[model samples]
Target chain A: MSTEQQTIDPLTPVLSADWGEKRSWTRAVYETGGGYDALRRALRDMTPEQVLTEVKESGLRGRGGAGFPTGMKWGFIPQENPNPKYLVVNADESEPGTCKDTPLMMASPHLLVEGVILAAYAINAHHAFIYVRGEILHVVRRLQQAVAEAYEAGYLGADILGSGYDLEIVVHAGAGAYICGEETALLDSLEGRRGQPRLRPPFPAVAGLYASPTVINNVESIASVPGIVRHGAEWFASMGTEKSKGYVLYSLSGHVREPGQFEAPLGITLRELIDMAGGIREGHELKFWTPGGSSTPILTAEHLDVPLDYEAVGAAGSMLGTRALQVFDETTSVVRAVLRWTEFYKHESCGKCTPCREGTWWLVQTLKRLEAGQGEEGDIEKLVDLCDNILGRSFCALGDGATSPITSAIQHFREEFEAGMHTPAWELFPYRASTVFAPEVTPA
Target chain B: MTQQSTGTPPISAEVRAELVEIGARYPQARSGLLPMLHLVQSVQGRVTAEGIEACAEVLGLSTAEVSGVATFYTMYKRRPVGDYHVGVCTNTLCAVMGGDEIFERLKDHLDVGNDETTEHVDGLKDITLEHVECNAACDYAPVVMVNWEFMDHQTPESAVQLVDDLRQGNEVRSTRGPRICTFRQAERVLAGFPDGLADEGPSAGIPSLNGLQLAQLNGWGPPPGRAGSDADRAEAVADQGRAAAQATAEDGQEGAVATEASPAGTKHEDAPGTGGEAK
Candidate 1:
């Protein structure tokens, strides 16, 4: 059951390179390691269109959950508009079981800043914004310091490296709202409105910030650009599958040994990832793991061989969302784990759209009942029905994403749920009755 | 053709002096609005019509101009709040972690539903408790915001203890919610457990509920002050027209140039489209 410690073969190493060093935020260390070289190469050898074309050729999908092709999204901007285009890096990584972005910002923010400059140049945006979640004050301070360092090093601000491509990068801390993780919602939040989803179609590429064409990229997506620019498109593309090209950060958590962010090729299997992370904790057999954050479906041990690629995972009925693989061992009950996640979705539902707001509530209610040993025969169907109602009906993907784990968990662990039907949870654990019923309640 | 002014009147001398004094402290004049609103909100308990008018007057803008900015955000309340404004997090994470329990406890304690505030315990009758949507502290699920400050990781014991602390006028520090529970059997039970709980018992199956269905069941609705700018101003202009009509009716004088506002979603030249993202 225990996975042995194995040396992981690291792929592309842009984000995690300087993470181990102290004061990695300083411009000196960043420049010494060939940082901002992409800016120089981009400004000197290429035009905005050329950089866009290069990225498009490189086949970089968004490192954000959506996994949209980054260059195709960039190409959507209308060239005729004279309005100032904006580059916004969505640092609002609030997904449960997803905790890679903030750590990146804390350890190595210069990569993000450099990525912002390169992306801003490619998109012809004069102003770039990094919309960070406000809850992480330390991360914000680190980023702010990194931005100051970047500005001082002349990587940011007007006329950077005398390329006449003047760019100003602003590090904005969003009053923490998970709905802000949605692109339009992030924009609305940036505009000082309540962080709620706006109708997309006029996606940020068309009528973004101040009605100008805006390019909103994920922190890892933008951060990945610097690496792609430095390392040729072929080098970046050679690591992964044809459709999902490049190395991604796989965040292995839960019962896994050495649980942390492991950068690997896209097509890496869960078994390989589990092996790389030193397998589950001793004596614990792998039960389930979320391929992405909790938003994606739960991939059980039976699916351990499934490639962690966009299409491959989808073929197996899950997404390679954010590459957040939260591993769980046998000690974890699928019912309890799903109930916890369902509760999270219900709590984070912005209440803007109907399906997510209401569906999440019902999901939580059902999960709570099932977890509390009060589940009915019809409860599983009801849970699935509620998830069905939420999946496509809600305003944003958050609603759909919320249902992935619930349905998938039920599909895998119907027995755990069935076990709870006739037994009351209090009787099963009489010694811990204080955890559920009141201490004053007399034993029957 | 139009008799009414589109913008607020030019800054008066007295107002200009205060604005200059306030504006000096901030790196930008716009940043001054934060403090200016704070001053105004403190001077008048809540943002009153006259208070908004005075802010507009002081800032050299129309009433709609100031109200537009204020109402667009949640912090500024259009209606009066109870002494203690209890804003609850009813999002999915909190919901699963017993948000309803905390909500019901507060409702029963305060004797009010979502938007209703009880009259003060002593001389302070301004205390209103609202079960608002997610306040974005999911790590600390089942959170409540008591007047802009967040109280996280609330169980029934924690929530009741929080309210008790608040009632005793003790300031609570923002903390993370309970660690991921061991299981339903091992987790801490919230205080004041009520009957008719939907998430438990024979009905304890995952419902085929969607966002819209959940919203309806849980009293979720669109946020207040969603009326777009043009519609709001038009409504105000229409109010002005009605006022003028009433005056004419009273004075026996014929009215000219109704100056009534058009319906909403119409564009205004002076107010730049507050679109895209917030600064």
Candidate 2:
């Protein structure tokens, strides 16, 4: 058998524990591995306020698309309120190229479960919910089983470990709407309304589920808690950059030698990650990649050395969303791929707001034309115009996320799109376009 | 051709009493129409022709009255969709991603198209296909909604696999919402089963570059008899571009993408030159 060589780094694959062990979902196995030992330490020694302060000092940010400060968001919840407060974990990893959350939830669910309980304790919330996307039922089942084990072992449910802090965890599934992936929209969905985004300011922390204080966070963000509690704040902070601290799961996918999740420091570059993943697939040159999910802009080979962090990627006009590195090879058509993505946003537009609803539709139309080699001179500009409408105007980040790929594709590979316009896609791929656009040629 | 009456009309004593109590919960009587329609559908299994008429009468409207609202959204059905409603998005986004291939696959599987339903199994039809606009999961384009439960990142292969799994009574993995393992018709399905055809006037035209080009040069709204003059076609394209730009401008971002690119949505010269990234 032919084996590929992979380079090693500090941020790459240190957590090589057996993923297929039996009863891996159990609290006992978790405790044996120094899990929820964090919870014991957190609940026994640290005050709830201290937990918040330590987490803030650690400088942990939300792992979901929006990199909001996790500690600050937790701090936003009213401490004095008597109403029911909640900790809802956004496990809806629907963004294209975002494969980090599911792996974490699948392989190490206890991490997230422990994080949720610890978080609920920190915020003094009696109840917590994990709003997982509906698709991954296995992960859902695993989480449900994990929570059951936690409750049975006194890690969750009333009077955990005799601390008198009662915490109940509910794992809820969302109807497949990307808008629900948005924090506020996820809250609206959890409340059983059509999943449209509500106006923020009364964020989930202030007025969430049933208008009670809520701390909505990503699964990865919550999962990091147990590690932070066990390792201490400074230990966690010492690993990464000065501003963007701690280790993150870098999910390397597509056209890579070893496409898998790598836990690394924040400022690691794509070149480093690729080296860890055994570099790009042999014989194929890397063309472009998404820094996070498809919702963030695509970066080309020129950016392979760009540091993978919140601030550096932000400086480059792309987000470090979920750290989902989807590397594509040279054979991939940027225009064709972007056209496919734009079509997705158009179809998924909730139609609640005008900019996203209509703008997405127009974007699909233009992108479809461009992909088919029918794009006129103004098509690229039209796409930019349409993306402009969607970026800031739409009710939620769903709209903004939809435009990321389109603008980025145009930014990096404008000529590929222009070439398509001059020659029909049929001529480029001949038999390929003929079969694809067969129905378009048929009479109604 | 006539305006239908508004408000709940006189119904049978039993149905009227039930609807009145249900209607009382909402501040606006019209909001009750959904739940009331649910009531009608449950009582009749499917929203029957008579049941629709009764709902209109109970709501104090004509048959066309309930039909209009029933067909406007995708939730209510005028005719019986298959036990499972397969609403495939054949719009531009999914279309470019080979959404039409799903239509062919479904037609082959169910032996039906948008206008037809397949042979029934276990008191329900195998499948039916309807083209819908964006289903809101663009990340997974070429999406399919099986009974309002989204199945994202779909391909012709995936669609075929899904149909087979549904046929074999295998548990389908639902992406969001309740995980209904079996094929059961939704209580409230929108009218025109596949397309909202029962509505007045025409539906949104499928815009294409070839059609747009022809419309720009020879003048036409869409196709065949719908063709307009070249000037009219150009005007319409311009208007669509302007409307898009105006909407963009209103959103506070510079409408630079639309305006700067084409200015008036004029077809740029099909020159072999690189396009600029709009952002």
Docking quality (DockQ) for each candidate:
0.02, 0.02
Worst 10 residues of 2 chain B by lDDT: B199-208
C-alpha TM-scores of all predictions: 0.64, 0.66
lDDT of all predictions: 0.61, 0.62
Which structure among the candidates has the greatest TM-score? 2
For candidate 2, write residues B1-279 as lDDT tens digits: 111111122335665566665555333344345445544543443456776776676667777766654443344455555545577766433454456677677778767767455666673335546765544343344568786555755677778888777765566655432343222223321110111111111011111011122223322121100112122322333455455446556642223212322123333222221221110
Best by lDDT: 2
What RMSD, rounded to one decimal, does every model reach? Answer: 20.9, 20.6
Put down candidate 1 lDDT per residue, B114-225, tens digits, no spaces: 8677655653234457765544343334567664344655666676676566555564443311111111101001100111111111100011011112222223221111
Off by over 4 Å in 2: A1-9, A12-18, A425-444, B1-118, B121-279
